[model samples]
Target: MRLTVIGCAGSFPGPDSPASCYLLEADHEGRTWRILLDLGNGALGTLQRFIDPLGVDAVLLSHLHPDHCMDLCGFYVMRSYHPNGAAPPIPVWGPAGTAEQLAAAYGLEDMPGMRATFDFRRYPDAPAGQIGPFSFTATEVVHPVPAYALRVSVGEKVLTFSGDSGPCPALVEAARDADLFLAEASFREVDDNPPDLHLTGRQAGETATAAGARHLVLTHIPAWFDVDTAEDEARAAYDGPLDRARSGAVFDL
Candidate 1:
């Protein structure tokens, strides 16, 4: 499996990276199957640098926040207006009211919204969900908005994504034994952050440490903060291999 950091900025797009998008791809059948974890603000444009947007097999949205899901508007336009004809509807798994939320984000009527362009479905609650060679499970996490942490596994390798959550047991459960823990670190430990909204670098590290995740990648550091500080704070808690998610970085497992 291959994971690409298309965007890593938190809350909003940063100069160095766009907001909260990650591309996960793996070989299935005779070809590659690609799924995006999130398509946040400014992510659609950056995504083209890696793979054809039309080639994405599925998209799993973490929440309805603009920085986490606003690009569906542009994506809807792309697939619906392709010169060859409308592309096949891609499966989009997200929280409840996903179709309505995306439609509202795109200034469209809530009835159909992007339904014709994308097949929107609520994330499967139990027994996991499957598409091609991957299986993913979602766990509710601590966030003011309805958010989830996803744990995706293909064969023996596991990849977990903490999609905008504060320190919580659900986050630890979602990351348990993951080969790569792509965690969000939006606030510095020194700052006074709101509870149940986001995680500090230290909290992210603590979660990974508690989950026994093998590797940790700190992501979603807002543009206002220094990424180095998050890394430093994480290092103090986690002894495993740690990396900061940068635009275009690839991790093959």
Candidate 2:
């Protein structure tokens, strides 16, 4: 299994990093499965730099926020204009109103340019079974908007993503014993004390410790915060191997 950080900025796209997006790929029995965790603003372009967009098999959206989904419009354009006729429909999993939210965001229901692009399968906040080689489960998180943290299992290796959340037991429980925990460290401990919508570095570390994750990858730090300081804070709490994610960083598990 391989995990790639396509983008890691929080709230909005920074000069150095784009918004939230992660790609996970695995191959089993001669079949390749490519899954995108989030497609935040400007991520489509960054994705193109690493992998063929047409190779993406699935997309799991964490929320309806623009920074996390704006580049879905770019995806629509690619599917629409591909010279090899229309591509097969890709499974899109998200919160309850995924279809409506995406249609509205890309004007798909109303815009002809977006409507005929791809097929969409919207799943509510429930266990929606499996997608190819991955089994998935969603847990609600504390955020201004309805957000979900996802647990994805492929064979014996399980990975969890904390998609824009505050300290919550659901996240800890969902990520229990995960091989890789991709957590958001959007703020420093001092500034984000009692964080409302996002996790601080220390909070992320604590979550990884409690969940017993083998590897902790911290992401979503704002450009304003010193990256070194945030990493140190997380390190203070977590004794295990910790990595501060950077754009284009790849992890092989």
Candidate 3:
């Protein structure tokens, strides 16, 4: 499986990167199947630089925050009214009311919404299942809105994605023994940031250490925060390969 960082900025789009979005791809039955993790603000444009919008097979959203899901509206436009024709309804897994939230964003609450282009399925209620070559499990995380962290495995390699979470036991469980852990470090370790909203770099590192993750990729950093400081703080808590996620970065597992 290969993971591509389409965007990793937090809260909002950054100068160098868009908001939270990722692309995961793996070969299944002699064909590569693509899965998009989050289609956040400004990510649709950036995503085109990586792969065709129509080629994505499925989408998994962490929450309804604009930075984590606003681009789905733009994507709906692409899938609904392409020059060729309307594409097939791609499966989408997200928290409860995901379909409604996207409908409101697209100003289609009274219309067809994204139903014509997306097959929406609420998470937690949707049992862990196979999407092409990958098997994934979603666990609720600590966030103001409905959010979840995910553990996805292909063959013997497992990858965990911490979708904008603060320090939480569920995050540790989701990332447990993962070969690669993509964690959010939105807050500074020394700041007096509130709890259960976002994780500090140190907190991210601690979670990875506790989960015994082999490699850590710090992501979802806001533009204001210094990546160097976050990396330093994370290194103090974790003793493994660590890298700050950047747009266009790729990891082959």
- Tens digits of lDDT, candidate 1, 1-253: 9999999999999998999999999998899999999999999999999999999999988888889898988999999999989999998889888899888877899987899989888864442688789899888898988898989999999999999998999899999999999999999989878899998899989999999999999999999999999999999999999999999999998
Clashes of 2: 0
**Pairs with steric clashes in candidate 1:** none
The best-first sequence of candidates by TM-score reads 3, 1, 2
TM-score attained by model 3:
0.98
Better of 1 and 2 by TM-score: 1
Question: Candidate 3 overall Cα lDDT vs. reference?
Answer: 0.92
* Sliding window of 10 residues with minimal summed lDDT for model 1: 122-131
Provide the overall lDDT of each model, using Cα atoms, as 2-decimal numbers: 0.92, 0.84, 0.92
In candidate 2, what are the lDDT values of residues 94-182, reduced to their tens digit?
Answer: 77666677778766564443435544555463555576787888888898888889898888898899999999999999889999999
Residue pairs in collision within model 3: none
Residue 162 C-alpha lDDT in model 3: 96
**What does the lDDT read for residue 229 in candidate 2?**
79
What tens-digit string does per-residue lDDT give for candidate 3 at 67-99?
Answer: 999999999989888999999999999999899
Ten residues in sequence with the least summed lDDT for candidate 2: 110-119
